[model samples]
Target: MTLAVFRSFPDFPPYGGEFEDLMPHLTVARDGTPAEMRAVEREVREHVPISMLITDVQLMCGSNALTA
Candidate 1:
């Protein structure tokens, strides 16, 4: 299993001296057969906390399904 984290900050300026908080995200991937990947996806969806939103998914280049 592999996990990736990403953070993004907007360019908009704040009213006060402080800038906006940075956004954080998490992405999980399991290198395996299609069936195994599906199983892992279901498990993660059920177990992971609700605060993190799995908004988008992009398979890595040469990755299992994307390459096929």
Candidate 2:
């Protein structure tokens, strides 16, 4: 699926071509302190093996909203 998106939008590369491989991940927090980050990690660990049904994808370019 990632490859298909990249192929479809060759001009807009993932992460602006910063990364060669794309992996499924979730950003728990940004610029968080060590203690704060650890707390979030512990909380996430409590709910291991999370699952969800993705029905739509949203693309954002800079501050512009682009729905896909």
Candidate 3:
């Protein structure tokens, strides 16, 4: 199974958990090729979420950057 971590940034919620606020998320796509996996890993190391990796780096999906 792919390793996905959810790190907490700022501070952990009062609920209390192993992770803080920000988490290190990870996931392995069973259908993804070796090259794709490598790229995904890189994105994760850079703190990018899987969705962004898939859309921006892989370009497999549309990268719809929303405005605040």
Candidate 4:
């Protein structure tokens, strides 16, 4: 799996390398084909800058889908 890492908009407060304080980052995209990824890259390169507001965050494991 590959991660397209990006810095947060407006920036997050930095914590002097503290383990408990996680780096402020948002994973833009997960694993994808090289062609698909290149498309995204092209768009990003051509588009103007934008801000992303992240309200909620969640994490899940396992590749298979799970029912609610």
Cα lDDT computed for each candidate against the true fold:
0.50, 0.75, 0.42, 0.47
Q: Which 10 consecutive positions of candidate 1 have the poorest summed lDDT?
A: 1-10
Ranking by lDDT: 2, 1, 4, 3
Candidate 4 regions exceeding 4 Å error are: 1-26, 52-68
Local accuracy of candidate 2 as per-residue lDDT tens digits, 1-68: 56678788899887778898788676667668899999999999998777777676555677444331
Which ten contiguous residues of candidate 2 have the minimum total lDDT?
59-68
Which candidate number would show the highest TM-score if scored against the true structure? 2
Stretches off by above 4 angstroms in model 1 are 1-24, 50-68
For candidate 3, the per-residue lDDT at 42 reads: 81
Using all chains and alpha carbons, the TM-scores for the candidates as numbered come to 0.32, 0.64, 0.28, 0.35
List the RMSD of every prediction in angstroms.
12.2, 4.1, 12.8, 10.2
Instruction: Tell me the lDDT of candidate 3.
Output: 0.42
Report lDDT (Cα) of residue 7, candidate 2.
Answer: 89
What is residue 39's positional error in candidate 3, in angstroms?
A: 0.3
Better of 1 and 4 by TM-score: 4
Per-prediction count of colliding residue pairs?
Answer: 0, 0, 11, 0
- Name the better of 1 and 3 by TM-score: 1
- Against the true structure, whose lDDT is highest? 2
Tell me how far candidate 2 lies from the true structure as C-alpha RMSD in angstroms: 4.1
